[model samples]
Target: MGKLTRRADFLAANGGFRAPTPGFVLLVRPRGDDDPAMRLGLTVSKKVGGAVVRNRMKRRFRELARLVLPEAGIAGADHVLIGRQGGIERPFEQLAADLRRAIAKVRK
Candidate 1:
């Protein structure tokens, strides 16, 4: 429902529950503000690739979030997708499935 633009938000999410997939690590942190809206953040470090690759990964992630997060994401929480080296090579369908699986795991 929103984007997390602050470094602090991302850092806060780092301390939350994590679900690791082949492509990415998903982090879910409840804000406790009772807003009922989910905020999303994406990170692709230089360790993964250069700017172009990172941008592409982010674009894919944005689309993935659009498709999946509305239904699967936790309410009033920050959800971050941390790109791994495997992410750029992974199939889009597989990545989507990975995200879904991550969400399911975090919900438990």
Candidate 2:
């Protein structure tokens, strides 16, 4: 898996499929090319809280991505995980499960 670094990549994924879970929103889009890796982006909006809270949510989302993406992610796709208000307080295992479900949903 790789990181989705460019603004265009994020916007493209946002324009694709969206799956909303309790912890976050998952966006996915195919690259439409030969790249075999799945790319990931994270977004934690300021409306969720202040910088500290937003960063904490991002940290949690990053860890969840690392745990779930390798086995569950779709190849040649860009994925963006958008943090929600309850993300910081959600249990790690639950968050992971949410991501798993979100990936499945987006792929379908």
Candidate 3:
């Protein structure tokens, strides 16, 4: 429902449960606060590519979050998608399936 913008937030989420897929890693961490909204964070490292590639990855991530998070995301938690080297080359449908599977794994 929202974006995770703080460095502390992203760092904290890094310490939580993670599900790794071929295209990316999904990290989920409960905020332990009153807010019930799910927050999203995205990171496409320089190792992935230059600015254009990273930005493209981010845009894809944002779209994925918008489409998938509402029903599948954990409320009151921060969900982070860390782009993998294969992410840029992967098909969007496959990436989406990967995300869904990852979230399901973390929820268990």
Q: Is candidate 1 or candidate 2 better by lDDT?
A: 1
Write one digit per residue (lDDT tens) for candidate 1, span 28-100. Answer: 9999998999999999999999999999999999999999999888999999999999999999999999999
- Tell how far residue 44 is off in model 3, in angstroms: 0.8
Worst window of 10 by summed lDDT in candidate 2: 99-108
**Sort by lDDT, best first: what order?**
1, 3, 2
Q: Which pairs of residues collide in candidate 1?
A: none
Model 1: lowest-lDDT 10 consecutive positions: 68-77
Model 1 score (lDDT): 0.96
List candidate 2 stretches off by more than 4 Å: none
The TM-scores, one per candidate, come to 0.98, 0.95, 0.97
Better of 1 and 3 by TM-score: 1
Q: Top model by TM-score, which number?
A: 1
Off by over 4 Å in 3: none
RMSD of 2: 0.9
**Cα lDDT tens digits for candidate 3, 19-86:** 99988999999889989999999998999999999999999999988988898888899999999999
Candidates arranged by TM-score, highest first: 1, 3, 2
Candidate lDDT values, in order: 0.96, 0.89, 0.93
Expressed as tens digits, the lDDT of each residue in 1-108 for candidate 2 is 789888888888989999999889999899889988888899999989999999889888888888899999988988899988888889999999988988898877
